[model samples]
Target: MPLNNIPADRSYTDEHEWIMISPGQTSVPTSPVRVGITSVAAAALGELVFLDLPEVGSEIEAGRTCGEVESTKTVSDLYPPVSGEVTSLNQAAIDDPSLVTQDPYGSGWLFEVQPTQLGTLLTAQEYAEKNGA
Candidate 1:
């Protein structure tokens, strides 16, 4: 699937996750970043039916499986693009999984974390090229 709408402001992972460091937060190590699966992943997963996200205050490792997303096609593990404590979850998306595919970058965001460190990440252009999107 063509991902023509990858946002330029955030960094992407090879696993198809995206992380957006909070705006106005210059220090990434302490900033709370928003995390979610990319449109490419959402499309590949087909229609989502269930979402299990990490609880707030839970410590998560970058690139590690933190939760799961179940779709009609398959059940996929959800990975955080950066490591830290989960600050919050998007309850709206949890309640309505379609929001994840409908608006992956907006209301579909999965969770937020105060990052302790970052993992390998690519710019939007790099991600597009890597995925052939």
Candidate 2:
């Protein structure tokens, strides 16, 4: 199956989450990072139907189960790419989960976090190679 194009600007988790350190932000700890699932993940999930995202101001740890994603195919845990306090959530995606698969990078973003630290992340090339995308 063909996967969606992977953007080169962000870091990705093996579990298929993508994290973009906000523009003009030089460091992970200084600014909020946008979090979302990679297009490959969205495709694999198969027509997302539901989402459970962390609340604003809630502390989230990288690589931990912060929320959940439910698709027609199966349900999967949502893992943060960095540890921090959740700054905001994408209410649009929560209201209509298909945005995740329909526009994985833009309006489909899941949340933003003011990160304290980051977890293991792979470069876009590395992620693509690892997943054979």
Candidate 3:
């Protein structure tokens, strides 16, 4: 899918990050959100070789470095689109870096999060527009 075609139901950030906001408010002030690398980011990285994800329960801040991926060309850092504690990582991607190259938006997702700040993200459409996608 084109990055500019952001789902209206979701939000995005300037850094080309997308957030899938969960329905309903919980103990946390806002809905929990899932984060993943943008299609643009994955494409630029080329074929991935290694992914270094944080352990679950680790606190992450918006715009802060959280992880890294080593591609055929170079290593790139993973940035958190929102502040939160990591809830999960894609085990498949950890096992096979190629998954990130093939399906970045799906099974290649790097992490799920319980966002501490929901306002830090942008919708898919917004990010796409800014990136000229």
Best by lDDT: 2
Over 10-97, each residue of candidate 3 has an lDDT whose tens digit, in order, gives 5566665556763232334354566667777778889999999878999988888888889999998877867788888888889998
* Model 3 bad stretches (over 4 Å): 1-9, 22-32
User: lDDT of candidate 3 vs native?
Assistant: 0.72
| lDDT for residue 108 in candidate 1, whole number 0-100 | 96
lDDT order, best first, reads 2, 1, 3
Q: List the residue pairs that clash in candidate 1.
A: none
Tens digits of lDDT, candidate 2, 35-132: 99998889888999999999999999989999999998899999998899999999999999999999998999999999998788887777889888
Candidates in order have lDDT scores of: 0.87, 0.88, 0.72
Worst 10 residues of 3 by lDDT: 22-31
Candidate 3: which pairs clash? 11-122, 11-123, 12-121, 12-122, 12-123, 13-122
What are the models' TM-scores? Answer: 0.91, 0.91, 0.81
Report the error of model 3 at residue 131, Å.
1.6
The residue-by-residue lDDT of candidate 1 on 7-69, one tens digit each, is: 887888899998885323345565677899999999999899999999999999988899999
Q: Order of candidates by TM-score, top first? A: 2, 1, 3
